[model samples]
Target: MSKEMLNALDALEAEKGVSKEIVIEALEAALVSAYKRHYGQAQNVEVEFNQKKGDIHVYSVKEVTEEVMDSQLEVSLKDALLLNPAYEIGDKIRFEVTPKDFGRIAAQTAKQVILQRVREAERNIIYNEFSQYEKDIMQGIVERQDSRYIYVNLGKIEAVLSKQDQMPNEFYQPHDRIKVYVSRVENTSKGPQVFVSRSHPDLLRRLFEQEVPEVYDGTVEIVSIAREAGDRSKVAVRSNDPNVDPVGTCVGPKGSRVQAIVNELKGENMDIVEWDEDPAIFIANSLNPAEAVDVIFDLDNPKACTVVVPDYQLSLAIGKRGQNARLAAKLTGFKIDIKSETDMEEFYAKLEEGAYIDAADEVETLDEAVSESDLTADEYENVAIEAAEDEATAAEEVAEANEATADQTEE
Candidate 1:
């Protein structure tokens, strides 16, 4: 042991978080093992470590007895008394048996033990540091990609973005920077494995927090999210402060804030809707880009709703392949059934036109809302068909005007 050894321990403590005291203790134990291996005998041994002098001493313990039966473990009374006059029987004594040539072996053993402990200490530090970040968001650069996974370098570690967690139709290249959600962290024997996801719903929520200060500070709360990664998503937001408009806050000035998030997500369209306690109002708002005339909740089954839109807007409300309606249902936790006001003609002309499968839509005459009994089935059919034609013509004009407005906005 020397000052150089102490200096190295201090460096380990500062740089690797390895305690010098712990390394000293481990080194003391290793010295005892080396003593036993070198001497090739069974004897009780004790190690003394002096921190101030950076010194290690090995001692053999022996019981003081008047007659020594085992010379290796028992000291003769004469010998004990030579060192100490008051030495008595059964008193354990320490004998300095430090090997003269042990310095070289001790130094080698200490180096190996300290290095092993430093690695373990560093691993524990990293595991604890990253565990706090589980389920949080991080920005990382694409390191590489293979058929099975994409490796993203997240500052301290390489995070795994598995194929299943990747966004639909999204591509990545080397050095591309993207934000990811830290979904899981596993402390494996090899190392800490971090799993990240780009398509997680919370990724969108976290992006909202990053871009929208009101959301990050808790003035606006995200109620729900439904996402079709790389295509579209819907978010329901509510304001904690009544004065602040939650939807407007998320959208920002001239849509700059939301557009930034959209660009980050590779142009994934997002719809921000004001959250409402009343299911009727929320369900209506969730159907964005489509005007809802009325939303009626099923009294028996609250998870179901009937939404009515103009005949021409029905296609927009249903979306291509009913994507809009499906995503709205997921966002609001309700199963939605959509109907058009002018679909009564299709219902009456099922033999010729396609059948109107929406059972909730029972269209009535234009004069007044007709009950089931006011007119026979045939009379109701005749009145509904006439009213449907008039509604259809008016809906077409509205649809055309909406298209013109959208085109102008795009320009």
Candidate 2:
């Protein structure tokens, strides 16, 4: 029995990651409590267990006195003398008060104590394990679902995916393993409470980290992520190293890396674009795949932008249900008013009809000579857009040449 108890402690220390000494100390305390409950609290009890002998010793301490007022707490000096001739009146005596049924009580108490300690140790282990992963990504299986939450088993503990944290129109099934962003790790009376999310922008960031080696190595950096989870996500990337192409590396050889991430996200579309410091250039990149003929910013109203696209590309720019336009608006923090060449011409014609009074002498009026051309206002705006792109290309080329020259000089 003693050997078994020692082995149990060893197992708990190894499995639950609790210290063996802690378990033993808890066992000693529990045994003391059990002895007092079973016998009496006034009796000074001591318990000793030997693994080799499989023996448990329980003794009650008493003070040796001339007269024994309480039999349980004091021993007569005559009786102490019979047990040990050296006994004096003031000497304390430890009488053998070993109870036969103590083995049964100890076994029950030990079981309870070990179980309680194991749970506490496991809770701590789970808390520490998930605490490090907070604000990061994790993968787990869908274990069960409650009224407004889904429980995911992430090896050591279960994480709660609340309804509000889930993407609208997304569903999970039993045994389905999915990627989740660990938003919060909280300690509770029950155990560690892990809040997970699938709709967060960071989920896209983590996916890029996993897919792109350059991102992990600090060669490629994800500047920003805007995600409408389960539908579309836009990521802006920058290259720290001149030799690396951030967008190309994230795309991978033959599009394998990005494809893998898309599969994980269950067919959510991703737009990986180069990050630019200039707001106009960044806004233009953010609205890619839809050719923006012009992106006119309102200086007085910073949140407003006038976007013109070719008549044919108008529907594509707006997307099905205006999703593309809406997403672009959200990403750029702009109230985008999209117009085709025909719509733009009609709008300017109305403006020309109204006599315009110049608020500032510096403000340039639309040249009637250029406006006479059937090409429309959008065509004129397209010229300005091209000029901006040309300047940006020239700047990038110069920067790259400088970096190349520096590298050559170093070599």
Candidate 3:
């Protein structure tokens, strides 16, 4: 029995990662509970296990009284003195109460206590193991599927890949290994329930971190990422080193690095663009696969922009259903309106024509001049020339006066 108890403690220490002392303490508690169950539940019983001696002892504490009413709690002074010569009235004493039936009860209680303790210890182990992997990418095998979710084995624990967290049109088969992002860990009555996702934007970032050495080493930085998941995604990258190309490094030799990531994503297309400090250039790069002719900023309403692409690439710039253009607007935090070359030319022409007509109407309204009143035909030419020169000199003097006034105002 002593050997079996030592073995249980050793197993608890090794398997459940509990200390030997803790297991021994749990054993003592179980024995005390067993003593109470077999004897009287109200008995003030204590059980002690000496680790070195392999001895187990049970004692019941009773208060000394002149007259004992309840024998379980109080002992008469005369009866206590019979058991112990030092016993005196009003003095508490402990009497041995190791029941013969206690060994059988202890065995049953030990099983229940060990099972409960081991289960709680296992839960703690699972929590600790997965907490370290939070916000990381993990690979798991598809174990089975219910109507609304799929269960995956992540080697240490099972994770749920819910239907909502899955990418559209992506499917998982039994025993298939898939990569997922651990989104959340929940503690429940049963155990730790981990929720994983494949559609999250961070999944892409983490994948790049895994595949791109520059990212891990701090030579290259991923600025932002946006995704539509299973269809297309965009990432903005920048390089700290002048010589090292961030895009080229992420793309790798013959597109090896990016291809690996793409294959893992189940052929989702990726556009790796170089991030720029200038918003105009950044937005232009963000709408790749179609060149941006120009970016027009509307400062009065700061959140709007107009982008022009070539007429033929208009559909491409806007994507099949404006996915590219919409993502660009979101990525740059602007209301993007895409136009083709033809649309831009027509708009500019209308503005120029309006300005020309305004100028013509202004000229038509100006009728009389001081030079016209001072003329004889040949003397008119000379008079007109002199008046023009005089007017130029007067205009120059007025401009000087305005500059002096402006300077004074500034001071």
C-alpha lDDT values of all predictions: 0.86, 0.80, 0.83
Ranked candidates, highest TM-score first: 3, 1, 2
Q: How many residue pairs clash per model?
A: 0, 0, 0
Per-residue CA lDDT of candidate 3, range 177-234, in tens? 9999999888899999999999999999999999999998989999988789899998
Task: Give me the displacement of residue 282 in model 1, in angstroms.
Answer: 0.6
lDDT of 2 by residue, 236-347 (tens): 8889988988888999999999999988888889888888777767677777778776666778899888887889989988887888888777677678888897887676
Give the 10-residue window scoring lowest on summed lDDT in candidate 1: 351-360
Best by TM-score: 3
TM-score of each model, paired residue for residue: 0.74, 0.66, 0.78
| Candidates ranked, most accurate by lDDT first | 1, 3, 2
Q: How much is the lDDT of residue 275 in candidate 2?
A: 82
Better of 2 and 3 by TM-score: 3
Model 1's TM-score against the true structure: 0.74
Q: Which stretches of candidate 1 lie over 4 Å from their true place?
A: 37-42, 62-93, 341-411
